[model samples]
Target: MELFSDDFTDGNALAGPLREIFAVDMTTATGRCAGCGDEGPVAGMKVYAHAPGLVARCPSCQQVLMRLVRGPSSAWLDLRGTMSLRIPMPAE
Candidate 1:
């Protein structure tokens, strides 16, 4: 599914639509933060995922952040605005 939008905010908002497109368990999805250089849960952070992967939000600066981003890994959305970091799924 397409990622990000002028109207998008939280990851939960895209979870349903994203799952419909990727057909993956968007509920258990997780990723690191490319903005704060931290890795953790992706719950409260605004997020979005596409063919590239997931884009978790950084809860520190509210930037459209990402994580573990190297070659073909999942992307992330920066959620530093509402919180420090979020993990929708339970810690592993």
Candidate 2:
């Protein structure tokens, strides 16, 4: 049997889906880890895509930052593990 390692990609993998929810790019947003209080860009988080949903974890403490699941008619986004997300916007 093949063992699973820490083979994962950066949070950039979420850009496509996240764009469907928000008008702006979410990969550039900053997320604060609720578990370790570490803050970094969403693109810097570790993303495991071999599962049913996308699991994003904090790089500092390996804490779950968010989970996104998409279906035919709906999508579920859980960000409870993330303290807050600082999304940059264009000047109005």
Candidate 3:
């Protein structure tokens, strides 16, 4: 996927537009990892712009830390995650 300077998808940079299009929540709630279950200090949250919606990811394992869904009383889509870009191999 083409990486944008900002976290917002399509470089819209507007919360309202995104909310209208996808489900999202900004206020994030911290929780222990379901996979590892090490609750000392969870990895920092990062924003990831996906096709369906924005997602949060744990820096430790690069797993989907959280998902943002549009809520009535929510603001911007909170995403604490990272994205991996796959550079297409040159045609042989």
Candidate 4:
């Protein structure tokens, strides 16, 4: 049996949900995968939204890069799978 479903959307799908949590566009940010050491734009990751929340995985090694769950009044974000994320910010 398959442990994971093949149905999923691209990282671009995360833009709306993430915008609620971050001030910047997270899809354009770059992240380093803890499992594979691969660094790339979050937009290049694969996003699965069928679960209770959103799960984003590395495109190179398929390692989970992040997870975001939204509640009625709050939101939870997990970045355990990513070593680090470089989010762009506008300079004043």
Ranking by lDDT: 2, 4, 1, 3
Error of 3 at 90 (Å): 57
For candidate 1, the clash count comes to 31
TM-score, candidate 1, is 0.42
Of candidate 1, the 10-residue stretch with the lowest lDDT total is: 78-87
How would you encode candidate 4's per-residue C-alpha lDDT over 1-92 as one tens digit per residue?
65575887899988999998888899999999999999999888899999999999998888999999999998999999999999998897
Per-model CA lDDT versus the true structure: 0.48, 0.95, 0.42, 0.91
- Candidate 1, residue 55: the lDDT equals 56
Per-candidate Cα RMSD to the true structure, in Å, reads: 9.1, 2.8, 15.7, 1.9
Question: TM-score of every model?
Answer: 0.42, 0.93, 0.36, 0.89
Q: Please give the clash total of every predicted structure, in order.
A: 31, 0, 12, 0
Worst 10 residues of 4 by lDDT: 1-10
Give lDDT tens digits, candidate 1, residues 60-83.
Answer: 555665332324444443234323
Per lDDT, the best of the predicted structures is 2
In TM-score terms, candidate 2 sits at 0.93
Over 11-76, each residue of candidate 2 has an lDDT whose tens digit, in order, gives 999999899999999999999999999999999999999999999999989899999999999999
